[model samples]
Target: DTTVKQNPRYKLARVGKPVNLICSQTMNHDTMYWYQKKPNQAPKLLLFYYDKILNREADTFEKFQSSRPNNSFCSLYIGSAGLEYSAMYLCASSRDGPETLYFGSGTRLTVL
Candidate 1:
């Protein structure tokens, strides 16, 4: 199959809590796309092939996947989204890092 896949295609996460997401490729495809979508909200861009694979579709395309004129972000904001809002904030990705790096009390994203 030429399909890119991520496990638990559908997930359940607490509104303000954390969730575990597992991704796998049956074909071991070259790339995988992780999309976070909310009810009635358009699919938001995540990242890209990340290995510098260029987009040949329109020639100058991106996101992770992007194209917007959305009216969802207000001054307070949600008149929609913008091309500038296409990434994960406070996210870290490491595969070959030191395992002894966790010596902290912890991390918590406080919303107030």
Candidate 2:
């Protein structure tokens, strides 16, 4: 199975503090993606990696930061946490793109 694993299923972050979420997969996929989801809203693509290359969405490019330290691991970093940032973050991996996305359960971040 091509499964993506995310750590810290739930996270509690203080306002203005930094928050970090992790994602990993053993399938050796060439691409990984990060998305943010909220109730009644569509999942928004935050960033993604094509092998060692990183790509961020035009609108959200500055709002989110990511790093793929290695082929099997990727991280989503939020420089400063805010109430508005509280949402379900999804990590996915695929051999290509959306067509084969294998998503993790997600990490729910709550800002206090």
Candidate 3:
């Protein structure tokens, strides 16, 4: 099976509560990624892990945070969900820097 799994295909949250999204990959890929994509916009890379190392995009460095509690699972945490945060959160896996990413259908977040 392809690696990567996410829960609650869709979610709705109030404007200020903390939001937690989950993802898992069974292939044991050393790398895992989390991206936020909005309608008609590019999938913005939020953060990724190479082994136990976490790397956040410079532009989004402060906007998002993530943790890989173990090799097979990872999470994207938004301390405070905002209206702007309403979008599709995608989880992907890649074996290395330049390769096709296997993605989940995504969890669409609606912040009201």
Candidate 4:
């Protein structure tokens, strides 16, 4: 596989509840990323895993959290869902830093 998978193509959460999204890739890529996209705005990088290393965007460090359980799987977790978090969650993979990313179709999250 090109190396990336996300579950629940779509999700709806109540405000203030926790939310978790899953992703996987088979390419054995060491670097995987998660981004949040909204209408009229650029996809914002949230966090990523470089092998066992984890990096979160400076501005988003506190807004989002992620973990890579293994080379083939990763997940993003939001402690408290909010309307502002309603957006498409994109999972991507790259061999290393600044490389082209292979993205999943994306998981659309809606907060109510």
TM-scores for all candidates: the values are 0.33, 0.95, 0.94, 0.94
Winning candidate number (TM-score): 2
RMSD of each: 15.6, 1.2, 1.2, 1.2
Worst 10 residues of 4 by lDDT: 92-101
Q: Rate the local accuracy (lDDT) of all candidates.
A: 0.28, 0.94, 0.90, 0.91
Please provide, for model 3 over 1-112, each residue's C-alpha lDDT reduced to its tens digit, 9 standing for 90 to 100: 9957898799999998999999998987889999999999999999999999999999888878899999888899989888999999999988876778899879999999
lDDT of 4 at 23: 93
lDDT tens readout by residue for model 2, 37-65: 99899999999999999999999888789
Q: Answer with 2 or 4, whichever has the higher lDDT.
A: 2
- Residue 67, candidate 2: Cα error in Å is 0.8
Clashing pairs in 2: none
TM-score of 4: 0.94
